[model samples]
Target: MVVIAKQNVVDILLMEAFYEMHQVRDRLNFFQEKYQQTFENFSVFMKKENENFEYFDDYMEWKAYTKLFDEVLKKIEELKNGNFQIALTALR
Candidate 1:
């Protein structure tokens, strides 16, 4: 049996959150490079042009990544600010 302190748990959560954020950012960067523009700009361009199936598919994926990136950033911020009780509670 092993005992883990609360601060240790928080530190682990912060590390995991940072890792997730990095992954999400990488995905966002891939989309940005593929489109040669930010998601918002690509979205606007898509709206102004005839809908191409490939672009549409990429758009959906890019949108999802964009949202996930934001969510991950928020999680990292919360963990950094010591608002990780919810995470610890859920682990119980």
Candidate 2:
């Protein structure tokens, strides 16, 4: 039998999420450059692609992956905050 801490699991998840996020980010940048269109904001890019849904499936998939990355990041932040609070309380 083996024991693993919850934080270890969260850390693993965070690592995976970061890797996936970067991959998607690179794809987004590649597509933007390929199309010769750049936007500082993801939402703006999404809006621009909305009109070309029939031809921009890859862009749309990247957008979905971006949203998933955001969700994972939010979970990581929550987990870190919870860990911090636990540490502070233990010290006190």
Candidate 3:
């Protein structure tokens, strides 16, 4: 078989890079929307389900939500704070 041209290889690699970039951008946007929606939904659920907030005293439940919010909201904050590179690095 004949070897491929360097120019041809570069063209193929460039196309692949653009395609991958589009995919990553789309995926990132999707998760950003989904995360906001899911958090708002569950927040509403929690408020409606727990009228008195008595559950706040429960270490098991409190720690669970605390951990979840810390992980999710921290990244959101970092992204908003112009530390998106850090957030992306952390994501990786």
Candidate 4:
């Protein structure tokens, strides 16, 4: 049997959260470079113009990535602040 310290668990979670944040930032950057605009500007453009399938698809995907980035950032902040609860159970 092995025991893991609480701080170790928090460290692991923080590492993973940081990795996720990096990945989400990469995705957001991809969309920004591709369209040469921020999501808000792209959204406004989409609303003004006739709908194109590719742009619409990219918009939806970019929107999801944007939301995920925000959520991951929040998770990272919580982990850094020690605001998370965790339970560990041993396996037989």
Candidate 3 per-residue C-alpha lDDT over 1-92 given as tens digits, one digit per residue, 9 for 90 to 100: 46666556545555665565555455544544644544345455556665455533332343454455455555544434545321122333
Q: Candidate 4, which ten residues in sequence have the lowest lDDT sum? A: 83-92
Whole-model Cα lDDT of every candidate shown, in order = 0.84, 0.64, 0.49, 0.92
- TM-score winner between candidates 1 and 2: 1
lDDT of 2 by residue, 1-67 (tens): 4667878876776687678767867876776666676433544666666567644675666567667
Candidate 4 local distance difference test against the native: 0.92
Ranked by lDDT, the better of candidates 3 and 4 is 4
Give the lDDT of residue 44 in candidate 2.
Answer: 65
- Alpha-carbon RMSD to native, per candidate: 2.8, 7.7, 12.8, 1.3
Compared with the true structure, model 1 gives a TM-score of 0.83
Instruction: For model 4, name the residue pairs that clash.
Output: none
Looking at model 4, residue 16 earns an lDDT score of 93
Candidate 4's residue-wise lDDT over 1-92, tens digit each? 57788889989988998999899999999999999999999999999777599999999999999999999999988888989888666768
Ranking by lDDT: 4, 1, 2, 3
Off by over 4 Å in 4: 90-92
Winner on TM-score (2 vs 3): 2
TM-score, every prediction:
0.83, 0.53, 0.35, 0.91
Q: What is the lDDT of residue 10 in candidate 3?
A: 49
